[model samples]
Target: MPVDSLPNSILAHMLAINNVPPPPLRSLPRLRLSKTINYGQLNALCHIRGLKSDQHSSLRLEAHDAFIKQYPQIYLHEKTVLPKVPHLADKRKSAVRLAEKKHQPAMPHNISAYLREARGGPSIDEEEITEEKFQEFLNILKKLPVYRTKHEHNMVWKILKNIPALTSQLSKEDLKILSKKVMSETWIKASTVTGDDGLYVLLTGQARRRIKVFRSLIEENDSIITSLYRDSFLFDAELKDSTVAQLYVPSKKLTVKKWGVFGSLKGGHEMNESDRSVVTDYDCEILKIPAKEYEKLELEKVKHENAKKLKLIRKCPFYETWPTLSIWELVSISKFKTFPPGHVLVESGTVISFVGYISSGYCNIYRNIVGLVDLPINKVKKMKKRVYMGKLKEKESFGEVSILLQAPFTCTIITGREVEMAVIEDKDIQGKCMNVI
Candidate 1:
């Protein structure tokens, strides 16, 4: 009989009874579904590994076997291995729990805990600096040069507060910036603090100005003269027009004491490009401010000085009758001046050519008197003595009488402290105030 026409059961029985192979194995549609799945095969029984992560990976990631260890076999009946679907009532309970978590009352407790921890940490900047520490910092800054102003002092404190030495922290990068940009150092005893540029100051130990010897001189007791004609000659070519025309070289060692500023400072007008070496006598702590930094601070000081002058003008009773334009013009024309203590603003016999408004500190007004009259009885006459006439306090004016009469004043005006003044010289106020004059 034809195998095609025979029934599969009858044909399989005949072939088994005749010891013949059961009708030749035939390919049938959908027959392969009954076979056991090979490893790493995709089928309807398994989905794309049910996205194993919260962030769904792509097919490219799947090709790289990222989806390995997903199941015992590549293809599995997902209904048996996957989590069971929740009932309607259970889903409703889950939704209620999620809502409660979203609207929880303890949220503020978490926020407050975070803030407390942040506060408990070490301070990072000036705002976090304690009062005691800030005061100590101010004291330390007094070691700097005299150019330090109240505003600049606070700013410098704020700027340097980030240093690890001050903050009690460690940072290689911050230290590098500070030591490079803000200051330079010399570690050895014989080394020079400022061999190049910048203002030099000693923090610990002492140093001396190294002066070259010009000649050797003999005295009663063996002595070396470090300076000759110091007060006399106009020696310093660099200080040609300055009042400090003479050169000075100290005979004593360790003349520059601790915390003493020596280079490129405001008061050091004699500082030149010459190699003036300050040899350290012992282990020294040195600090330096670059010339550029000094220039920047000078600008800020000028701004503050101008504002202070404006304030002083408003306080002067003499300016109360002046018009607003005149006041502003005076403010613009006034020269802000600073004088050191014991400085003679106007000598006793010299002409007083400028009117001064003492903006800060006090001054002593003195009249030169004949100590003893030149008499025939005494062989030598006594020198003139200075008698204190009065005090010129802040907001007081000087040279007003001299300017009014266009004559010289007999009294001497000496600064009692470092004084700041708003000076209006005759040349500056020339023809603009003819009506007032």
Candidate 2:
């Protein structure tokens, strides 16, 4: 029979009636304790075993009583007489020695052994993660602490790249740099305000806007608490495009909070200390980038490109009569691209991708003309071949007529040397217009 099933009276009766094998050692839970990580887990495990969430035996007598109850058999020694002692007189005297048995429960001498047993002994089992849990496991990989700084940056960059709100505005290279400058953190206790004048992403767990509450209301469970989720982007969550970055799939059991950013944008994305504070409902993992630093970083990317593109866009004679506002719009659409010598910019009878303005070098125009084949081994035969035409020089534009009329280019154009051009592509980028012209 299991020791836990034994009744106090029956166990006593059995011990009194029969001889049994040596008493076995067992563990029982002790008092509840204020935790410390792995120590806390052990304490919680004790509580699950009907122990008081601690490993400590507060009173010596309590463990003694528990030990005796669990033990299958216990023994008491019989009293005995001692050997006779020599007397100073003629007679020797017999002495009696009293037998006394004191019971004491055995404790662990090796701390490591005791802890191992407590943690569940060495038949180490590894559980398999099922298909249903793959996503949750993937979320675990996103944790920054698991990887080194550079690796973590790359992981974050991958996530940022997928987010349409950032992708639509910033280049992949810009987002990569942004990922490196950001910081990630975790909070398990309710304390400080969230969104420290920065943008944030809650990677895991739940949290809520901590508002004021009375003790009575809390005790009665009548006070309402606003809950939050693993929102991929907060703090400027609503971008200039008016789209909120989303991550967590909404559970039918929970509703999303109507609040946009966790804090006010005016406060540089910081929660107002007087009335607003975001606290973890349990444990939370978050990534953040300071607002001021983010702006500075973005400006560096903008200024580097803007300085060059501004000059190139001004070279367009079509914009000579256009306003500065319209010129900047052109700058927004323009992308600086370079091509190696012999690279084809356009082909006759094919759609042109971009309206290009030559910034450096030139392009050789060609026409498909029916002419004799030029091969030494073969007799001359009439075939369609590329016939060299004139060249398009620096500051010259192409694809304007084709794009305006929505038709294919009339001639083929190939780069003469390593050529650079400021171009506006004629394509649909998720329905966003690329060329203002």
Candidate 3:
């Protein structure tokens, strides 16, 4: 029988009977004999392996083509196996590992010990400072050529100016005396050292003058003088003119007596006619005024009187109780005026200066008393009489409550006698005092 006409069962029986093993299943090598053979065998293999026939056939064909292109020698061999490949080391990772291995050990925990080791020796001990040691140091400093020089004087003055406590303790009069002594000593020293008057003139005439003026302003007690000192740039402009000296001379000589608690108690005792001693009064010429400048002199006199009034006001009970009212700030905004006897200082329902202090006299306090009855239109209007409150004497203050409350005065204040008052304006109290407090 022809091979193409044989029944498949009979052929399989015949092959099994002859021990042919079903004509030896076609090998993978046979599949490459023709493209048609490869496709048919691959599809049959896929069916037997339980995979999609078309997909498996395409994948296998592509892998076979790649293998044949890369290795033409082994592409046709069915039993060939690929050789093992070795992994390459990364150059960057190897270099990092080598650097870590070559580095020095970790640094010592103690910083000073590490520094000593690095420096190759122990460090030397610094000199200890004590009071005695400091004194010796000061002595050494004094022996230096730069000591007491013009530069040193300037440095010392700058130091003193910066220290408020030290400057506050020194009065202007004290600074004047100190300036004279320093100038004389510096003049002598400069003359001896340089063997010429040039250094002496530079030291005493220029340097010492500057020191005196600076120290005087720094230690000044009067706000007006301080303001003038600032306005004149440490008296540089004003001191150049001789006439300006006359304007400030009265302020320097004027003194205001403060009534302290002890002084008041003593004054009360001495108020008795028997205990009071008769005193003689004398007029001394404090400043020489030319006839042409008589009006200018009167204006200066008024200014001096006002400065005295302010000085006394600073010692009043109100200022003592509230120390935040800076004397300089108060003097800048306050007014000093004298009121005649029976003149009203403050009236009820009126806004005026917030507070006033009796500098040299007394004032009486009165409050309006409201009546209950309604008056007829034709009836004569009875003047509302104000009830008498107490009296405010010298060194006492009034109107602080009205100033604090920002309201009009509730009572009337009248001068009981000729009264000298230091009035702190309502605007000033709100502007300056409230900010500080």
Task: Report the number of the highest-TM-score candidate.
Answer: 2
Ranking by TM-score: 2, 1, 3
Q: Which prediction has the highest lDDT against the true structure? A: 1
lDDT of each: 0.57, 0.54, 0.46
Ten-residue segment with the worst summed lDDT in candidate 3? Answer: 256-265
Which digits, one per residue and each the tens of the lDDT, describe model 3 over residues 197-254? 1111111121111111212323348665665455442232234353333221112221
lDDT of 2 at 102: 29
Residue 37 in model 2: lDDT: 29
Per-residue error for 127 in candidate 3, Å, reads 86
- The better candidate by lDDT, 1 or 3, is 1
| Residue 253 in model 1: lDDT | 45
Ten-residue segment with the worst summed lDDT in candidate 2?
A: 252-261
